[model samples]
Target: MFENFDDILNVDDVAKALKIGTSQAYKLVRSGKIQAFKEGRAWKISKLALINYIMNQQ
Candidate 1:
């Protein structure tokens, strides 16, 4: 199973994992529905944060 917050993922990764569209993934980040950071010119999401968000959604 996946583990740890150090596992940084990109927008596509988040989309695939969550079965969402890339635009929706970006929307989540932009709307604060998810946590992420911009590294250089790319947006990165923490696996732990995604999991936490999913859990809290219930």
Candidate 2:
């Protein structure tokens, strides 16, 4: 579904994809609602993980 985004997405990318605020996106990552891993101090989410999260939400 997210064909326009990169395979690896950042918080801002996720926010745009979900049409939510960056804080909300961060909350998802922090709360483990969306699967993510930290690279240094930033969160990285795979495109497949995002798709899976969306699918599971429905």
Candidate 3:
């Protein structure tokens, strides 16, 4: 699931990739911990941004 995803991922997708809850994923996006932008009522996160975030954590 993590290996294949669209360029922009929804909060649910982020949660699955990180093995976290949707609520926590939303928090990460809301607080700018995970690079994302609001599109209408949805959050879209970049694949590169997610990768960067994971790398930075290490």
How would you order the candidates by lDDT, starting with the best? 2, 3, 1
Candidate 3, residues 1-58: lDDT per residue as tens digits?
2568888899999999999999999999999989999899999999999998998999
- Full ranking by TM-score: 2, 3, 1
Question: How far out, in Å, is residue 4 in model 3?
Answer: 1.4
Best by TM-score: 2
Clashes of each: 0, 0, 0
Model 3, residue 43: what's the lDDT? 92
Q: Model 1, range 1-58, lDDT digits (tens) per residue? A: 3552248888888888888999999999878889888999899898887888899999
lDDT minimum window of 10 residues, candidate 3: 1-10
- Model 1 has an lDDT value of 0.84
Question: Each model's C-alpha lDDT?
Answer: 0.84, 0.95, 0.91
Least lDDT summed over 10 consecutive residues: which range in candidate 1? 1-10
**Candidate 2 whole-model C-alpha lDDT, 0 to 1:** 0.95
What's the TM-score of every candidate structure? 0.86, 0.95, 0.92
Better of 1 and 3 by lDDT: 3
User: Stretches of candidate 1 above 4 Å error?
Assistant: 1-6
What are the per-residue Cα lDDT tens digits for candidate 2 across 1-58? 8899999999999999999999999999899999999999999999998998899999
Where's the lowest-lDDT run of ten residues in candidate 2? 47-56
Give the winner by lDDT: 2 or 3: 2
